[model samples]
Target: MKKLILALAVLVSLSAAAQRSQDKKKMDAFITNLMKKMTIEEKIGQLNLVTPGGGIATGAVVSSNVEAKIKEGKVGGLFGVHGPEKVRQAQDFAVKQTRMKIPLLFGSDVIHGYKTIFPIPLGLSASWDMALIERSARIAALESTANGLNWNFSPMVDIARDPRWGRVAEGAGEDPYLGSQIARAMVRGYQGDDMTKPTTMMACVKHFILYGAAEAGRDYNTTDMSRIKMFNEYLPPYKAAIDAGVGSVMSSFNDIDAVPATGNKWVLTDLLRGRWGFDGFVVSDYTSVNEMIAHGMGDLQAVSALALKAGLDMDMVGEGFLTTLPKSLKEGKVTEKEIDQSCRRILEAKYKLGLFDDPYRYIDTSRPAKEILTADTRKAAREIAARSFVLLKNNNQVLPLKKSGTIALVGPLANNKNNMLGTWAVSGDPQTSIPLLEGMKNVAGNGVNIIYAKGANITNDTLLAKKVNVFGTRIDIDKRSPEEMLKEAVEAARKADVVVAAVGEASEMSGESSSRSDITLPESQKKLVRALVQTGKPVVLVMMSGRPLALEEENELTTAMLQTWHAGSEAGNAIADVLFGDYNPSGKLTATFPRNVGQVPIYYSQRTTGRPATSEEFKKFQSNYLDVPNSPLFPFGYGLSYTTFSYGDVKLNKNSMKPNEAITATVTLTNTGKYDGEEVVQLYIRDVVCSITRPVKELKGFQKVFLKAGESKEVSFKITAEDLKFYNSELNYVAEPGDFKVFIGTSSQEVKEADFKLQ
Candidate 1:
């Protein structure tokens, strides 16, 4: 019987191996045959993915004759078009009219969600729960695939620190270690283990080559940084996504060292493909290739050849490849082999997407109504939205508002459903969303009288409103003047014991193309909040924003403040749940909120200078800002709970560690206050000395713990050499033998420390 079982097991393993071998052989033969029949023009066309004019205008190029081009086999893929019916129509045109009958790939910027929106990427990162983050992506994939989108331009893994950069709201926060982890999680969620699954979409790690480090926190600005800084702080997440086998990469619009990322060979070929072995297609970010002309990198043809030769596989939106590549090939500027290679990569991606096997796999019109924006999806959005709210302050335990009280909800976003969905909410239905007014009414019940007023417009300027409403109408100005609005808000504040002031930038004010030179609260809204504070009522400030704002005055004047970044469909209900003791606030700040815009690029993991500013007293030679304090308004991992929590001294299992050995660090946390709460127990490490300079503190590990009132729990973390590795001057990641400090605490500023030596 044992011999028979062994034979059966061997037969099963052999059958699996045979299947894989056959699949590889089939793919190779298919590509070889297709390449032989393809002309240089056809090959270049296959490398061109474009968006159409009739659909949503996500970028500069929207082809006027999409149908004619698809029939001529001049376009390989399409993006920006949503809905199953529309996608099916495009796919039908490609399959039936084109000579090759090759299926066209459909991609979309489904960053956070498709129909039922989740929190923005930065807010999602604050959860620090990999499974939850992955689950959010999975749901996004499911919804997108059901709506005929097989590719997602998502998991924006750019490591950013400056809150002034509008796109900072779209990526993982400052630290490379955490950013890489989140990048991998998002990729896994989007692609899943089985890319052939109909519900999954191809994951594209985006804005390659440091788009986050835009100078002066302005969008589309030139970016310049050393290669060492790139490898050490910025490049890890992209590498992590590549390691996770992401299907594609989107080049950034910013220039790296005077060269645009889309045309830079060192970044696309040498670093990404040759070094990292990323066997995927590289797409240009919305006409970034043609924009290179503006960067003084020669004309369109020159830039096209440079991009194609540099290993860029697909030209997104930019017709530069389609219009100039043929001329380049004939002129010997671009070899035919380069075109063939790019075409093969695109074909390989299509094959991986299983498009050749079933061109109509994701085109089911019924699925949209049945699966998109359903009750289950809204519930998931609410759960994630609740998790994204970072409690900035809870002085005197002002939060968890008593369920039976007159709560005055004042400000622009208090009852506004349009802004609840936040920025980059493509296909998300705002009408279905619960506004802050509705959420409070639901949570407080009929017994609680809720007085509401629109404090002020998001911004008083008309030009600002026009720019912010690029996608849709966000700010609706009332006929009442600013003074009248303030008077009404003050009246509401006088009537209620507690005032919930919902104020921040408009939903469209801080996203991809929405950058602000000044990141403080709009003057109109700040005046309204100041007036409410004078009413002598305790105010719970609920800020709705996409990026972190400079809230120096708000922090001091408000009794409690919640950084509720554009929570999707159920934004109001989720905020109300926390405010009324239904749900405990657990969200922590992923990005540091700067005290002032002058203190830009401030993060907890910054390197210690040779003359570090150790004392509050400033010296002329020290690394200290003369105008502002060298501290963020709220540090990374900083959050407040309804109840206070206390931390004990650090307990180490050993004082010394051998090479490649692990050590245990533990701390006791007690919820000393009257209510239950959740705390993020952060663990940071510092190498005292190294061959090269090191960060003052690097977040190595963290665990979010929940406890009832007066409950005590021990939180422990295991540390290894992997946690200590950093990119040296040579750009090689290694751990050096040295003395290390292990700091465990609630936030980066407050910590208990211990020392150990590693040899």
Candidate 2:
């Protein structure tokens, strides 16, 4: 029996290997045959990515004379074009008019969700439900593919600590472990183990290296960090995506070690292709190759050659590759073999997408009717949105608003649908969105009286409002003055039994090119909220924004506060669910909320300084702030729940464990409050002493569980030496034997400590 089993296993392995060899041979033969018929211009054209003029213009690089270029065999791929009809029109031009007859690849920036928008990526991370986050990506793929897009620039897994960076809205928040988990889930949801499926679009893991750790929380700024920091902190999520079989990668706009990522050979070649074994092609961020000229790399032509040698295969929305690669080859600056290699990668992606099988595979005009924004998709969005809403404060249990009350919904966001879908939901329809006023009415039914007022514009500053409107119509200035709007808002609050103040950024206030030095609430909203609080009615603030807004003042005056991050198409319904107790909020803060902008880069995982800021007796010369506290307004992983939970002392199975052995830590948690709720029980580890200084605490494991009011459940986590591993100064990932501290609790800030040792 053993001999027969071994024989069968060997046969199966051989068969799999043979099948892979056959597939590779077939792919190589096809690409070789096609390249033989192509001229240098046609091959170079295959590497160019151009955006069609005027379809969903998110970026500034809409290609000029796009139709003429496609016909001339000067264009490779097209993005910013939507609808099956438009995509088909461009594909037909390429296949019928170009000499090579190569089908054009259609791409879109379908981040977060498509037409059936879900919460922004940061908001989604708060849920900490991997399955739910993956489902959001799945739905996005379904909608985007139905609309004729074969490639999606999505799953931006940049691990950002600086909330002031507007692009944080596009990523999973800090903590590489959590970001890596979310990254894997998103890749699985998108690529789905098969890129050939019509519902599964190819996933592109973006911003190649550390685009998240920008200097001073500035967008597109240079990022400089030690090799150990990259391996241990910011680079894990991108590696996770690659491990999950992500199909493509996008280069970041920022430079690392003073070398632009788009033109950095060490980043694109040695590390990504050599160490990580990433086989996917790298596409430059929008015009990044050309932008390298401004980085003092060289002229446009020189930078283009540098990018090609650096291993960037696609020039996203830049004609740099199209016009310069051929010139560089003629001048002997670049070789034809390099051009052919990149062209082959482009062709390979198309083949895997089944575009070669049928040029119109994703362009079925009928699919949109059945697949886009269906009832089930909207339902999923609502559930996920509700799960994403972090209950920041529920003081006095002011939330779970009673259905019988005459409620006043005040603020510019109260009745606005334009801002509901948030940023980068390019295909989302504002008309289809249900506003908060409608949501309250839908949740409360006919018995409740709901009054609403446009308390203030998203921001009353004229220049700021105009700048924000560059993205969308987020601000609608009333003919009435700010004072008049405040008067009406106060009057509405006075008459109501309770006030639900809808406040925060417009959709454009926290996306790309929208960084804010001062992340505090707009002064106009602050005034309106203070007036409402003076009304003596319990005010519930529904704060909607992408990044965490500093709400120190609102946190004090408001009886309850909810952080609803631009909850997508079903924004109103989901917020209504949490407000009416239909859904118990379990979302935790993935990013820290600073007390002020001065603490912009604050996060939980900081190395222990010589003078640590503890709550012991104050030391004047310690690392303490003179004006504000060193602590954030709310720490990372902090969130409130309607129900209270009691945690028992952490119990460890052993006092020590060998390098290869494991230790089990257990905590007994009871729902001590009145209602049943979900809790995200967190586990943090601290290396007491190490060769290098470690963080004060680092989140290692977490479990999301549900418990009835009085039910107690013991949650156990098995920790091994592998969990203690970190990249040393020598750039080697190692686990040093040492004493360790284990903490288990609801959040990073609140935990029960236990001591253990690594033998």
Candidate 3:
């Protein structure tokens, strides 16, 4: 029977391989024949992707007459525009009016979800449940594909340690290993097994090569880091996305080393394609190809040619190739062969999407009512949002609030539905979101009284508020003064048995170009929170932001603190679920929440410093800060549940093992506190010695397990030499025989360590 099963497996594998070969041949033949009939202008047009009016314009559209361009065969794709009626109109123009009838690809920043919004990517990563993460992407793909989108600029995958980079909210946090896992899951979820399926869209793993490591945690800033650092930490997630069969890549706006990522052949071609073998097309970030001039690379034509040589296949919103590539080709800077190669890649992607067969495959206007923001999708969003929320503190059992009591729901965000869907909810409707006031009322019975007050404005910083309002009026000044608002909140808290302060950033504060230097609760909200606390009530602070905020003071002040992280569409309902003990939060912090902004880039996987401080004790000569301790307000993988979990000492199968052999690390986790809960049992590994210095620790594996009260489960992880592999001085990935340490923990900082050796 085993032999028969093996034969069947081999047969299935061969059949799939044969199908892939045939599909590739068919795509090549189709593109080759199409290119043969195409003129130079037409070919360059196929490489140009533009944003039409009435879409989420990230940058100024270089060409506003996108419909005319499509008619002229000068536009290959349209993004920023969603909805079937508009997309079909654009598709109809490309098919009926264009010279070649090339169907334009419709792309969008479908980062989390389309219509039915889910949590931000960072918040999704906090769940640490790969299946759940993948399902979120799957649901996102289903809804997006139904709404005329064939591509997604998602699964940002860039490993971010600096929370100050506003785009940090878009990526997996800090650790390369965990980021890689999430990257693969997102890829699988977005692309699924077939690109041609109507439920899936092409996944574009974005910001290629370390955009997350922007200097001083600023957006689009120059990122200068050692190659060793790149391969070990930053590059892994992109590579993982590639390995998982991501269909496209979006080049970042930042420079890698000295060269901008959109025009770096060494990074894009030599490494991404040649080394990693990513066959998918590469799209430039909005106007990134033309922005090469800002990088001082060359003239418009020169940069266009340079980006082409650097393996950029599509010029998104720049029209660089359409306007300048032909000029560059005539000047003998870029060859026709290079242009053909890129055009073919784009054509092949469309073919894989089955767009060539039916240009209007995604243009079903009827799917919106049937598929978009359905009850099922909203339920999924609510469930996922609940899992995405991280419980930072639950001192005095302040959470799991009794549903029968008088609860004061206070803050700018308490009743505001506008900011509930978080930052990148391009297609999400704010009206669909349930506000905290409504959610609490719904969750509590008639026996409960839910009082509410807009305790403060989203923020009081004039300059900051002005900037945040660029996208929309998310924050409006209250008619009542801050003092009056606080008085109302205090009175509400005084009347209630418990207080829930719904406060944090508005939706626009932590997305693209929204970096924050001081990542703490706004002073107005802080004052409000302090006032509520002074009312002598047990207060639960609910933070709603896209990135991790420093909550050292709040952690000390509040009876409980929850990181809601701008959870999308169903934010209020999900928060209410946790508050009312309907769901136990199992989400963990994927990024380090520093005690203060001074510890900006602090992560769990930093190298052992030459003069490492032994403890928080101030060692004057050591690598230590004078005023602040080198500890995070809340460490990565740190989250609390209504019930407490106790992890037993890590047990290893062997003290020593051969490089080929695997070591099994096991830990028994018990739900020591009352109530059923879930715990993410994390497995972290450390290389004590290596070819070069290694990080203090790296997250290797994790398991999310559910345990009822008094129930214990043994979580085990298999660690092979592959888990120990790292890029050495020569940039060769290898595992060195050395002493290693394995940590089994609930969080990175609090762990039980066990040492082992590799032979």
Candidate 4:
């Protein structure tokens, strides 16, 4: 036994030594070769990363002039150019034409899907299923790599609460714990254990700083927060991605504490590189280095020098580095060592991607044509789309609508294919998508009578119309006027047994650079909805939007509502399936939907003030809004099922526990409604009193339960000291030994609680 243990120990030591040696050898070789052949221009070129001017392209070679650049060694890497053919051609220019023949890396913004569109990032996050989320990314990498693309600018790990932030649709909602989990999931999904595989791509966790907390929920606005606030609330997801071995990071556009994130050494170097120990290359957001001049930081040369010294490895699309880096090097504003360090890192990425082995490995022309948008890809899209739909309101068991009756599908989005693919869907093809009218027709068959009308355009405002038309024509104005469209819709509602009004923002209206001050439904669409409601028909509102909307009035008037935010290729079919009982809606809200725009930035986990308002009387001189309710219209983790479920009392293992010990809390849930359904049982913790003020409630854990009619089951969560830890004023993370309340329920607002203490 002793001999065996010693032998095993020896083997482990040898393996570890071999791994270290291999890594050192690879790094040494890359650095040596880079130093030997690199000219001052070539080294500076390594810091220069550019995006292709046209539509999304991927490959080693994208531009016609790529050959010239490769021969001259004037470029380090290329992004926004994809596909095996283009990548191969580009690789050929570098490997076959250049003296040093350093392979170029390729990247693209494969946010949701490469070809087969899944739900938008926010919609996918609503599922709150980490395995499923990872699988979506895995499939995305499979399709993307198959097309000869290797890097993905995705898993935007920003924590957003404000619905008005259009980019909120691109990240996991407000909680850091959940966001961290999702960040790790996406990293695993994209890179897997081995990125050298044909199916995996390097994961680039983006917006490295606080870009989510843009003021008034506007995009690219100034961001300011205390260091403690950042560490406790916003920085966890990026750290989690680093811990998960993500290959790269992208600096955000927003400034942190009056300094642009791209040029903030405290953020990029002291925090990310030194504290977090992240060894990945840092890429700046699009033209962010140049934009720093507008941000009042400095001139292009000064800002570019600051960015490089601050640890920004790649400059994307700014050309600030290309134009000014040489002068900075000559003036000693930046050193040769810094340039070599950044260049070596870029070379290391290419080496890790196996581009050194064979530059043309991914550039197979046959694969793009064969695998880009196949039938298998569309099937995955349909499944993922169905999972992203959150059933918001279902009264009188109105949903799973009977297919035999006359169904009135009234709205602008009902038959629209253009808006099916939501924001940041660069490669999704809408022509092959299933529109709502066609989907319902296919599902309902000839026996069901379907009536449709264009209730309203996404918006009547011409300015809003132009903004939404940035990518393509989203608001296709109907020939008839608004009054005419409403009349037709109302008339259809009067005749039909049920009405499904598909309304919300056009595709381009709620994405990057698409922030809106007001998040209410467009006036023309609201008028149409009010008219249809007056007809006294049972209405099912199928909302197609990217961001969370303030829909208090719609909630009060409509019979049922479903938030189907850009459901991709199978959107219409998925909606039809749920409406007529083919599939049960299981998605929850990743973001909070507010009652009014005045109640902006409302979320479940928020710190309690000295004068916290727990009830109506506390509002007089407390932290409460004067006109609007403190609560959101729909809280985070809020959703509905066709069936009803009831929660019983929470049972704790013990009334008291030690600091290092753990306890179990269990709750009994009974499915009281007719159909078998899924329910997300949420567990929230409240530190009744702490050294520092704590949130009213923090989501500690949750479970998704499946039960049949009249069936009951118990769900339990294990509590740990780590789960209770929070950053105090001294910036130390520790769990205070005190009274803690555990609340378990369907949503954050509605819950049953029990108190416990730690000794």
Candidate 5:
């Protein structure tokens, strides 16, 4: 019977391999026939991705003569434009007017959610639920495709440690393991199983190499790190995305190892394509190919040739390829084969998207009303937003505010809808978003009296406001004086039994080029918080930010604090649900919150040094900060629920295992508090000895389990030798026989440890 079953499995596997080979042959033949008739100009045009100036332009320039270029077959793809009608018009020019009659691929940054926005990527990561994260991406793909988009630039998988880097809001935080898992989930969500599906858009994993680890946490700054560090710490997420079948990649604006990522052959070719076997087309981040000229890579024509040779398939919003690639080819600086290969990749992408078969596959015009921002999508957004919120602090159980209380809803974001949708929500409409006051009223009902006050403006600095307001008026300064605003908030707090201060960064304060040196509350809002606290009222601070903030002062002042990462569209409703106890806050902190800006790149997974600080206290020559402690204000994977959970000691099925064998680790988690809640049970492992130094602890596995009050559940994780593997000094991925410590915990810090070994 076993032999018969094995024979059947072999047959099935053979059949699958044959089918894949057949499919590849068909694709290659189709592209070859198409390319044979294409001229040099047209082939180079296939590498040109132009964005018409309707949506957001991250770069300085939008494409000029876009319609004429598309009609002339000088443009391969179009982004920054949506809607079925608009996309159909763009596609018509490519297919109808162009000589080759090729279809134009439509792309968009469908990051979190489309139209019906969810929380930022950082907040989404906080949920620690891969299924939920995948669902969010699925919904985004559905909505984006409904609006005629076949490609999505999302799942920015850069593993960020520094909260100062604004784009941290756009990624899964810190840990490569968690980031890699989310990357896979997001890719699966966006692309689904088949790219040919009209509802499934192609997912683009972005910022190709180490854009998050910019120097001094500045945006678009240079990145330098060892190859070992890259493989072990930063490269995992991008690898995971590629492994999950992401259709495309976007190169970062920053340079790697002093070479611009757009022109770095070692990274783009040697590592990504050669090592990882990524077959996807590579697109440069908004004019990044052109910007390489500034990186001393030479003129436009020179850099264009460099990028093509480096394996970058498409130039985004930059006419560098359109204007200079033909010149480079004529000068023999770039080969016709290199150009052909790049064009072939882009054409393959279009073919996979089913664009070649039917240019208008995604253009229904009817899908928008039925699928976009519908009641179901909004409900999902609200539910997702609630789960994305982290209960930073809840001293004396001050949260789960009574529905009957007279509550003071105060701060710049209290009644404001403008900042609800966080950064990079290019498609979200602020007017459609629910404000905090409105949400409180809707959730609290007639039994509760909700008095509102604009405590202060998001910031008093007009210079900073101008930079952030490039897209829209995110930080709107009020007409009233700061003193008057504070007085009004204090008066409201006195009248109410409790205060809910909605404060933090405006939507544009932390994304793309919005990095901050001091990641703390603006003075205007800080004063408002201080005044409200002085009212002697129990304050429930609803903090909205794109990045993890330094809230040491506010933590001491507020009775309760919730870190809501600019909850989108239904931000108000979601905040109200958590505050009113309709949904318990289960979102953990993906990134660590620093006590101050001094601890810029603080994270839980640092490699142990010979002179490592044993505790918070300072010691001579020890790796410790003199002023601040060696710990973060809020550690990664830290979150609190209305209910309290107690974890039992970890129990392992075996103390040692062979390379091929697996072990099991189990822990009893009990809900000791009065409320039912969900807890993210995190598993971490440390290699006691190895070929090279390893992180003190690395997250290996996790499970989000739900328990009712007083209920206990045994959570187990299957551990294998594969989980113990890491890249050594020689850059070989292997697991050496060594002692290991396994930790099962709520957060990285608070955990029960058990010892094990791999033999």
Candidate 6:
């Protein structure tokens, strides 16, 4: 009976494979036929992606006369235009008014969430929950497709170690293994099993190459790294996204090895398509193709030709392809075959979307009310926000405040609605967001008496405020003096039994071009916190920022600290839930919190030095800073729950294993403290000997488990030689037979170790 069942399953799998092969052949034929009917001008048009001036433009350029271009068959796709009605109007021009009647592909930057917003990508990574992350993407897809958007430029899986880059808020932090896992989840959630479904949208894994490791922690700066380092440390997440079948890729603005990503043939063709086997069409980042000219590549015609040859199929918000491709083709710099290939790729995408059959399928006017921002979606957002918050400190058990306490909520963000939704939330409405003060009132009701005061502005610097307020009035300068605001806050703190100070960066402080040299809290908020801390009342600091902040002083001064990365739409409700003990925080830090800005680009997986700094004290002739400790304020995978967990010594199933054989590492985890909670059991592996130097410890696996008070459970992780593989000097992914050390515990810094070997 078992053999019969196995045989049946094998037959079903073969049948599915055969069906997929046939479908691919059919899709190819359809695209080939469509390409034959298209004119040379129309083919080039299909490669051009433009945006109308409707939504937020990340760059300065927005296409003019968009309606005429669509009607004249000069435009292929559009972004920044959403809503079923508006999208239908644009689609009508392409399908109903154009000669060939090709449907337009609508894309949007649905980064973290759609209408019902969730936490930023960095905060979502802190949860370390693949299911929750995937669910968030799924919700974003559902809401976006309902609004007639078919493509999402999301799942920014760039591994960022530098918080000063600002774009770190938009990605999974540091570790390639963890970043790769998140990349897969996000792709699965956005695309699902079928692309033809109306509920699913194509996912574009973005910033194609390393845009995160910008020099001087500046946005769009040059990135230079060795190929081995690229493969082992930075390339996994992008590879994982492609392996998960993400439909599109966006080239970054930065250059790699002196060649801009948008025009690098070795990167786009040789590495991505040849080595990794990524079949998706690549799209240029906003005006990235044009920016290559500034990178000293060449003239517009020269760069545009280079990009098309480099496997970039779409030009986003740049008319480089539309304007220069024809001349380049005529001048023999580019061939018609190359143009046809790009045209074919775009047409294939439309066919996969079932656009050829029904161009207006996603334009149902009734979907917005039924699918967008429903009660169920908002509830999910609230729950997910609570889980993303990390408890950095809780001295004397200051958190989980009593419902009957007289609480003072004072800070710039406490009652503000403009900054609730973090950066790149293009579709979310800030006016609909619930403020911290309002959320506390709703949750605490009559049991808690909550007093509110405007402690200080988000920042006192007018120049910085103006730069941040480009999108909106994010950091509003109050007419009242800073001293007056501080005085009001101190008075409120004195009257209350406990104080909850809401402070941190404004929404625009850590995204896109918002990089900062100094990553500490603004002096205005720092002074506000200092005053509140001196009131002799237990102060619970609810810190909100998009990236890991330099919080050494704040952590030392505050009674309790919650690192909430601009929890979106339901942020207020979620913060209230955690503060009142309605939910226990299960989030762990994805990025290391630096003690100071001097320790920029700090991460747990640093290569072992000849003379390593083993302690906080600086040693002469060692790799240590004299003024400050080498340690971070909080290490990666570090978060404190309301309850406590203890791990027993690691027990191995075997001492040695072959390349194919698996070894099991087991540890008994107990909820030692008095509350039920979830703990992320992290597993790190160290290569005792290698041809090339490796990191002291690399994250291999992790498991999040829930345990009741005093309950003990045996947790196990299976390891094979595959888990030990790394890119060597030759850029070959291989695992050497040698001794290995395994550490299993709560975070990177705190763990228990055992030994193993590969034969």
lDDT of 6 by residue, 408-526 (tens): 99999999999999998989999978889988988887989899999999999999999999998999999999999999999999999999999999999999999999999999999
Residue pairs in steric clash, candidate 5?
none
All candidates' TM-scores? 0.96, 0.96, 0.98, 0.96, 0.98, 0.98
Candidate 1 per-residue lDDT over residues 1-759, each given as its tens digit: 999999999999999999989987898799889878876777777888888855444432334477778878898899877777778888888789877888899998888888888888888888877888999999999999998899988889998888888888889888888899899999999999878898999999988979999998889999999887888889989999999989999999998878889999888999998999998899989998999999999999999999998888899888899999888878999998888888998898888889989999888888888888899988898888888788899887788898777888999999898898878877787888899999999888988999999988887888888888877779877788999998999999999989999999888888888888888899888998899999999999999888888999999998999989888888999989888878888888889999888888789988878888977677788888787778788998888877889999999999878777989999999999888878889999999999887788988889888899999999999988888888888888888888999999988888999998888
What is each predicted model's overall lDDT from 0 to 1? 0.87, 0.90, 0.89, 0.86, 0.92, 0.92
lDDT of 5 by residue, 1-759 (tens): 999999999999999999989988999999999999999999999999987784334422234478889888899998887888878878888899999999988898988988999999999999999999999999999999999999999989998999899999999999999999999999999999898898999999988999999999999999999999999999999999999989999999898888999999998999999999989899999999889999999998889889989999999988899899877888889999999999999999999888888889999988999999999999999999999999999998888999896999999989888899999998889899998888988898999988899989999999999999998899898898988988999999999999999999999999999999989999999999999999899999999999999999999999999999989989999999999999999999999999999988899999989999988889889999888898999999899999999999999999999999999999999999999999999999999998798899999999999999999999999999999999988899999998999999999999999999998
Candidate 1, residue 499: CA error in Å?
Answer: 0.5
Model 6 collision count? 0
Can you tell me which runs of candidate 1 are displaced by over 4 Å?
Answer: 1-25, 55-64
Query: Could you give candidate 4's per-residue lDDT for residues 170-262 as a string of tens digits?
Result: 898888888998899999999998877877889999898889999888899988888777888888999999999999999999998899999
Weakest lDDT window of 10 consecutive positions for candidate 2: 55-64
Stretches of candidate 4 exceeding 4 Å from the true structure: 1-21, 55-66, 616-619
Minimal lDDT window, size 10, model 4? 55-64
In model 2, pairs of residues that clash are none
Error of 5 at 145 (Å): 0.7
The per-residue C-alpha lDDT of model 4 at residue 737 equals: 89
Judge candidate 3 at residue 521 and give its lDDT: 87
| Per-residue lDDT over 1-759 for candidate 3, one digit per residue giving the tens place of the 0 to 100 score | 999999999999999999989988888888899999999889888899888655334533323467678899988888877778777878888899887998988898888888889998889999999999999999999999888898998879888889998988888888888899999999999999988888789999988988999999889999999999999999999999999999999998999879999999988899999999989899999999889998999888889999999999999888889998877888899999999989888988899899999998887878878998899999999999999989988888877988786989899999998899878778788888987888878777688989988989988877888899886788888777899998999999999999999999998998899998999889999899889989999999889998888888888888988898988888888889988999999999999999999998889888987999899999878989998999888899999999999999999999889988999999999999899999999999999987798888899999999999999988999999999999999999999998999999999999999999999
Model 4: colliding residue pairs: 57-80, 57-81, 57-82, 58-81, 58-82, 58-83, 59-87, 60-87, 61-90
